[model samples]
Target: MPSKPLTTYVTHQPMTAVQVLEKAAEIVAERYFHGDVFCSAKATKDFLTFKMGGYEREVFAVMLLDSQHSMIEFRELFFGSIDAASVYPREVVKVGLEVNAAAIILAHNHPSGVPEPSQSDKRITSQLKDALALVDIRVLDHIVVGETCVSFAERGLI
Candidate 1:
């Protein structure tokens, strides 16, 4: 029998949501918060992955914002076993209350590397919109972040 060479593969790490967003905020604040710098989807995803490490499955998050739309908190609310995560409107509302968030920006990752919102994604956003409306919390945007990120408010999808 002939000897064969062994192969190795790189493994990715994981990080908390706060770590990811803090880096993003730092980057945005450093170059674009009060300036004219443009942040593309690729840039955002790179920043997140660099700070938090790559994700293996889908994860949904909520970025609580103040009245000025600045980030107050980054929360990873739910983790899905596969490509989809279950989002509870009531739980989201509770989180909004707990954080005293005047507005929120929702985000989720697609393990498949596609950032386009599915029909279910839109439906969930609409539901969350209606639920939050009851409590007077505005949904500033729903952003899907993966290989790319799309913003509902930016694209007028919402």
Candidate 2:
């Protein structure tokens, strides 16, 4: 038999590590979050941890939800240095309005591997809650992702 060219054997390009992880996250989100009712803090924490835990820098994300608490969207809205991500209430509200979200769950990753909510986190959560309230959008919880996930609501902070 004649030797075939290598090009004929390659059907697709390989995925980078990041691409693989992104695809995996998408699969998990579709299976676990999309159109699913909010049931427990542990579930939320697990999802957020999976989504945000691997970042080397800070990322602020929002889980926009419907009136029935089904997920509308999960968006990473802000990026920052290894230590902090600037979260803007107005921008968050704009995203919420764009999605017509009835509620939101906030989440961020700490590159420092600490899951404790900082004072700044508390302040921004308050600001976001107030801003979202103006449009009748509820702020359900704020989660900090690090070595583990911490729920602000669980700590009576929300």
Candidate 3:
């Protein structure tokens, strides 16, 4: 009989956003985060929007950061429904100002398991990037999360 294949299991404790990105930054040549890159990127913006109960169901989020391409704060801004949520660029800037963030990353999830960006998603990111740019805030990346994830910066969407 063939020898039983070795079984290995690895358990990971929950990690904070900062912790997650720190690890990714170390390995990936480009910035990467676990969930919605838009929401993650946006969390790095001055303010964060938490929306609940329309689409994504229940998922808390934050925007990971880097200082002039270095790591800064991992700002967890809100909790809300995925399908519908309010995103205020002014408020985001306000939060970015409060945090003194130089750049931003955005991330959010799709509970329906599709990571594609909707037209609204692209429009909102463009609007936010334009809005934040006026205030000297750089929009680094926007990510969408589902069974898999996608990045706007990686796709040249940002």
Please name the candidate that would achieve the greatest lDDT relative to the true structure: 2
| Full-model lDDT, candidate 2 | 0.89
TM-score of each: 0.72, 0.87, 0.60
lDDT (Cα, 0-100) at 90 in candidate 3: 77
Q: What CA RMSD would you report for each candidate?
A: 9.8, 3.2, 11.2
Worst 10 residues of 1 by lDDT: 32-41
Model 3 / residue 115 / CA error / Å = 0.4
User: What lDDT is reached at residue 34 by model 3?
Assistant: 32
lDDT of 1 by residue, 47-129 (tens): 44443235778888886767766556778888996689999999999999998999877788887877889999999999999
Ranking by TM-score: 2, 1, 3
TM-score of 1: 0.72
TM-score of 3: 0.60
lDDT of 2 by residue, 81-150 (tens): 9999888899999999998999999999999998999999999999999999999999999999999988
Instruction: Report the Cα lDDT for candidate 3.
Output: 0.61
Ten residues in a row with the worst lDDT in model 3? 45-54
Off by over 4 Å in 3: 1-66
For model 2, the superposed segments whose C-alpha errors exceed 4 Å read 1-7, 11-17, 34-36
Q: Whole-model Cα lDDT per candidate? A: 0.74, 0.89, 0.61
